[model samples]
Target: MLTVDNLVKSYGGAGRGRRGGGPSEPEPDTRAVAPDGSRVFAVGGVSFTVEDGELFTLLGPSGCGKTTTLRSVAGLERPDGGTIALSERVLFDSARGINIPANRRELGMVFQSYAIWPHMTVAKNVSFPLDILPSSRRPPRDEIDRRVRRMLEVTELGAYTDRSATKLSGGQQQRLALARALVIQPEVMLLDEPLSNLDAKLRESMRFELKRLQTELGLTAIYVTHDQSEALVMSSRIAVMNEGRVEQIGTPDEIYGRPATRFVAEFIGTSNFVRGTVASVRGDTVAVDTPDGRLVCSGAGAAPAVGAEVLLSIRPEAVSLARDPHPGAVNQWAGEVLNRAFMGDAVDHVVRVGAQEIRIRSHPTESVEPGTRVHLSADPARVTLVPA
Candidate 1:
């Protein structure tokens, strides 16, 4: 298990002046400075706990501090505050003045670039970490060779064991990097956008392979990425970050279906935002008035008060469009198809309803041409009402 408590880091300090400033010392918290001279918090007070053998992911947009948090855990960057612990061992504690060296932390890391040594063969690259072991504790030469071969075979790189890392393709290099990391047998693996370098198809395949390896080895893994689909497909739980803070943390389904905040609802997936004022609240549902019409939505956490301004977040897949209206639906809107886009297995339609535009997704087989009048309806329980 890994636990992080109130981690914080700032770059510039009194010794480093602003770009055009004179010899005078810069502000104490210059790293946090904004264009207007206000302090910018790269990482605010962030805390989370990951279970043993859990595949936890930190997901967010670029500059959301996901990478900063990962570096802090790896000990490459010292946080100005907070504590980090792995399996009850205190690796970092600002108050206690304890900061373990990165090499002594016993954690493996794989980067987006793979970071393989071009000068070394696959076997040498995987065996390099073992060189740090004390002479008295180091394994025999044959044992080391056997273990390296096993790791290479597990990662499907045995055939290239003697090949220089630079000769491998992007995907092969990525697998080699993983093999090298696993060779050390660390308790936790930190992956920093490891699949970002691969093509779309390869990225998808690697996600499954990485998940399978993590499960098979019962290794605790912390993956960091800005790609929402990657996070959704691989992580047991995702911590969504924004502006140096964790916005929400939950399983993929929970985060997608029941986002805790407006930021999360918009960040995790495509959502049609309908601005309106709450007309009424009934049980878990809330009635809101939009430019198109009144809509009954399933409020995420709590029902908004009547007349309060809110936004209805409706997923494209949750909406259904028909040439004729459906009976008994709590909400329906008549619209003209503005545009249609064909996705491989699905079709997306942009419908213009009065002054608002709503997106709907359907099977590719179901065709709705532009200029056609359509009736759009959704399950009331699928409409999510969030604060505007």
Candidate 2:
């Protein structure tokens, strides 16, 4: 129930320089001119919609403008251009000069730090938002208490209601932050790396917890994070952002299985990129001649001309390994395992073929020792082509 149209935001000239470094592919970036003519473009023109009861996510590496976009919608950052609305109600419109105050937006937000009030107890923290409202807008004390208690129950913090906020564990503190946000009954919740502070195991477990909470409450939310796995596990749909622009937007399956760009292909998961040239094209099917072998891929969005340079993205899980060649399989290659890793659930094998190194993920029970000869094959449908 949220719409952002051509939303743009920028930072000061002092923040311009090398972009944030991380494990991401390099993409072109566009700069904007602030009112004072400084190089500022934290978020270029971006547009997306969050359907009702959907947990939509803006996912990317740091400095990719995911957080900037979220803050702009939260009314924390005034956009340089564009309009934002919640359920047809205008929240921001640069052309109309109608920017609402952050509090007036009626949106809930949980930051990366949790922001739990140290001196307050669990129940008090959740009730604080409702208690501070104007008399006309504020609920009665009994109503506020009811909301706070229900929010605590939804977050499974009822037993800890009297405990000081600072005394809770990291995950508990995060839930307390969420309880506080929900107590306000916001139209939409904005979460920016809400689980980043937790341990790895806690972070994984909280993904399901957060997803369950959103589904059960039927909450429409916009989540921002750099964790692809988290986005895949928790988001109803993901917007893959790069250099302040959204490279792709779709369900996790569609985004990961059919990435629109190389940045998305590389960002979402571990992919073995194979450079190739278009040998032929038949409708949506394309055949790319890589150094390793010929790869015929179906479901290609673009029809490239013959001899066009392209990159083929193949997930390790998509590559099937066997001791013997299937003889009639597509995109089959013969190689020797360069290295291997036992990943509990599966075994990862790095196979060297011709001059290319391809990663293959096989069942744990089907582990092939390093230095062993093997056959690798991937279905044409699983091989996606990225136009260079």
**Best of the candidates, TM-score:** 2
Cα RMSD (angstroms) for every candidate in the order listed:
5.6, 3.6
Candidate with the greatest lDDT versus the true structure: 2
After the best TM-score superposition of candidate 2, give how far the Cα of residue 49 lies from its true spot, in angstroms. 0.8
Candidate 1 ranges with C-alpha deviation above 4 Å: 13-39
lDDT of 2: 0.88
Per-prediction TM-score: 0.90, 0.93
Q: Model 2 over residues 1-388: C-alpha lDDT tens digits?
A: 8998777676676555323222332322233364555655677778889999999999999988999999999999888777899987999988788999999999999999988899999999999999899999999889998998899999999999899999999999999999999988988999999999999999999999999999999999999999999999999999998887788889999999988788999899989899889999999999889887788999887688999998889999999999999778978999999999999999989999998799888899988888899998999999988757
Worst 10 residues of 2 by lDDT: 20-29
* Tens digits of lDDT, candidate 1, 72-143: 999998987778999779999988989999988989999888888889998999998776688886788887
For residue 314, model 2's alpha carbon misses the true position, in angstroms, by 0.4
Poorly placed runs, candidate 2 (over 4 Å) = 14-37
